[model samples]
Target: MVRSNDNITSIENIQQAFRGVDYICSKQIATTLYLAFRLNKPILVEGPAGVGKTDLAKKTASFLNLPLIRLQCYEGLDESKSLYEWKYGKQLLYTQILKDKLNDIVREKNNLAESLEAIHQYDDIFFSPRFLEPRPLLSALQQRKGSVLLIDEIDKSDDEFEAFLLEILSDFQISIPEIGTIAAKSTPYVFLTSNNTRELSDALKRRCLHLFIPFPDAQLERDIINIRVPDLGDSLRFQLVSFIQQIRKLDIKKLPSISETIDWARVLLLLHADCLNMEIVRSTLNVFLKFEDDIAVVNDRLYELTQQATKEGHA
Candidate 1:
């Protein structure tokens, strides 16, 4: 049986539920989820990479105790890949096993025309749900108890694929020519995330509630670090977050994300480092930055970065 959001009756409850799962979110996120649930609409979450776009869906599933069905989008994604495909191997086996029955059904029909007509009657038999392979999109629709469907990185998919999602997003159903349209047994809570690689169609955007998540502020990042690494001393956490926030201000290919901050904190804990210093930061720079160029750029200003972080930590 599909569970309704009768339990999550208010925005405050949404915030509490997400907090219970250790996903610290702003009131905007809570309000977005609340409205999406109340309206039965999908949410389009747009933000830079690693701002917790994917984590939001995972945590929501945990909070609701529902199964999460994730479709990781990429270039050249299409309906057959995302929606459904015929189980050709199973269908072939079925056809072989049913050969005798087929012969018996056509025995009375002596003419070729009659035999062809008899086979046409059973054409749809092979195309039934039994022979259909459900992909993430179809699987979500088939769930009796509903699910949380996360379409991660929708922007990477081709324009054709984006258009293909229109019917499913607007109607909570998919049309299979062989089997006709399949509607959701229980509408899943849908979330589509984008890193803004490209602009999404206004048509697709129109069907969803838009939510933009930017980088966390210093205090919020500190709170997140505390939640993620509780054993870390407050002073170190402040310095690390402050350093990251400052680095974000510099022109870089990729800024350190909230997850990376937590990871750096864990690294410091393992090394038994109580504070951010030039030596420690230099060695652990790779923990946060992905590219060597980004590391070198930050390294050029390591002294200045360290001094500022230390000053902010003291203040």
Candidate 2:
């Protein structure tokens, strides 16, 4: 079961809030979220992909008992897609119904346009609620229940999309030309994550508290592996994490992350292996190394490690 926001007080509590995460990351991410909640500011997180940047927002929402609203950013994203748009088909149907009620052809056409215009005036009704279709930001605003709105991969978006968010964050309000403005009953706790594929505008960064998440060091990686794969014996856990860390240090195109450490350990546990040996490491190498090129690279390195271990054992 998850704890509520009322139970959270300090940065450490957020460590417990997101279980199975590294202590350094847990603290940094939790502090970012805590500060956001305390000051009503958005928290912007920048990191490499698969580094738990997106997961931090999810844990925060779950811990706080808030609704999670996720906006996946991509190339070609625009205001209408991010905010809202009218369902023209429904509007056309409403216009046709009004046309049927009139006798004169000219009057019928004029009445249809007036009727369509009146639909916009109904503000409270008539409009097909197409503009009412809630994107992440708007959904968070409309939520009477509290929400955590996560704008993911903001760097993938164009500058125009970033510009649009500035007003929404400051006011917690969105303006619809047909329906006027809508404001939140309570502002959502906002978290924005980026893979840093592109540089974000300074204007956007200034609106939020910021955090940069890097990959974990060896000790933290071991701790994370232990938590994620608890059944592994202490000796094996240390050995495998250390070995993976050593392997990651070599000249490889891709390095295993804290997550990959956990995955490798879990794979070992499933195999019921009690120790790290040449056969076990080679058999389960897939967890730590993903691509065929990475595997080939590690396999050659593993042979070297095996020879070193054999030498040490003989001595």
Candidate 3:
């Protein structure tokens, strides 16, 4: 773990820390994380699915030794779900428990006007933080030690929700009608990921530092496989990564991600396969491709892919 008082102040240090955790990242990613930490700005990490956008946040938290608070966004997500909501059941029980006290206070009141005034004095009691169930957004703010706040897949959320995030992202605070404003005790390192399901608003984009994480190049992919699946032989590792790289070049519904590459590597390790071959590749094609159509397409080209991998292995 990278200590808080250590060398994380530099981009090179950031890269070294991530590498310590076996997460091989490019210089651009290291720089983005460095700036996000130094400037205390939210990072808008846009990339294809399974390219390690979400993993970046998790690894940063582990490297920094901070808690990771994740809010998984989806269609129809709203402020109440992502932010805070009143604990209605708890509030109701409290209200029931306070009924006797309320009656006793009202008994001393002269008339309806006095009784109303008495009730108004305690109006804010129900809306306090005790009864406020803090969701991911609000919970991040309340962390005195700070945290890594990851809003995963923000593009899946509604436009209204995106607009709501603008204030929090910019100011590190949230506004509640009951409570005028709730500022962060300690500003958290924030990261928002998008799969590009829809275009985010310019206002939202303007407030964040943007980064695009594309698929890793062949060498980087191989390094990642080596680190993650160390039990595999060097020969098999090269052939497997090369095969996946070739698969990504095809026109498919979903390309195999870095995660899938690691998965395939592990599967091969478990099967005690030393190198890529037609029979083994055919049997494990499902490990790389997801859709049935993608499987059929790769099946048609499997022999050729294996031949190419074999030629590269001997070269």
Write down the lDDT of every candidate, Cα atoms only.
0.92, 0.75, 0.90
Candidates ranked by lDDT: 1, 3, 2
Report lDDT (Cα) of residue 23, candidate 3.
Answer: 93
Which numbered prediction scores highest in lDDT against the true structure? 1
Model 2 spans with C-alpha error above 4 angstroms = 1-5, 20-25, 97-131, 303-315
Q: Lowest summed lDDT over 10 consecutive residues: which window, candidate 3? A: 1-10
Which ranges of candidate 1 are over 4 A from the true structure? 1-3
Model 3 Cα shift for residue 286 (angstroms): 0.6
The candidate, 1 or 3, that scores higher on lDDT is 1
Per-residue alpha-carbon lDDT of candidate 3 for residues 243-305, written as tens digits (9 for 90 to 100): 988999999999999999999999999999998999999999898799999999999998999
- Cα lDDT tens digits for candidate 1, 1-315: 255787689888888777789988789999999999888899999987788999999999998888999999999888788999899999999989999999998999989999999999999989898888899999998989899999999999999999999888889888989878889999999999999988999999999999999999999899888888999998998899999999999999999998898899999999999999999999999999999999999999999999999999989
Instruction: Please give the clash total of every predicted structure, in order.
Output: 0, 0, 0
Q: Which residue runs of candidate 3 sit more than 4 Å off their true CA positions?
A: 1-6
TM-score, one value per model: 0.96, 0.83, 0.96
- After best superposition, candidate 2 residue 245: deviation in angstroms? 1.9
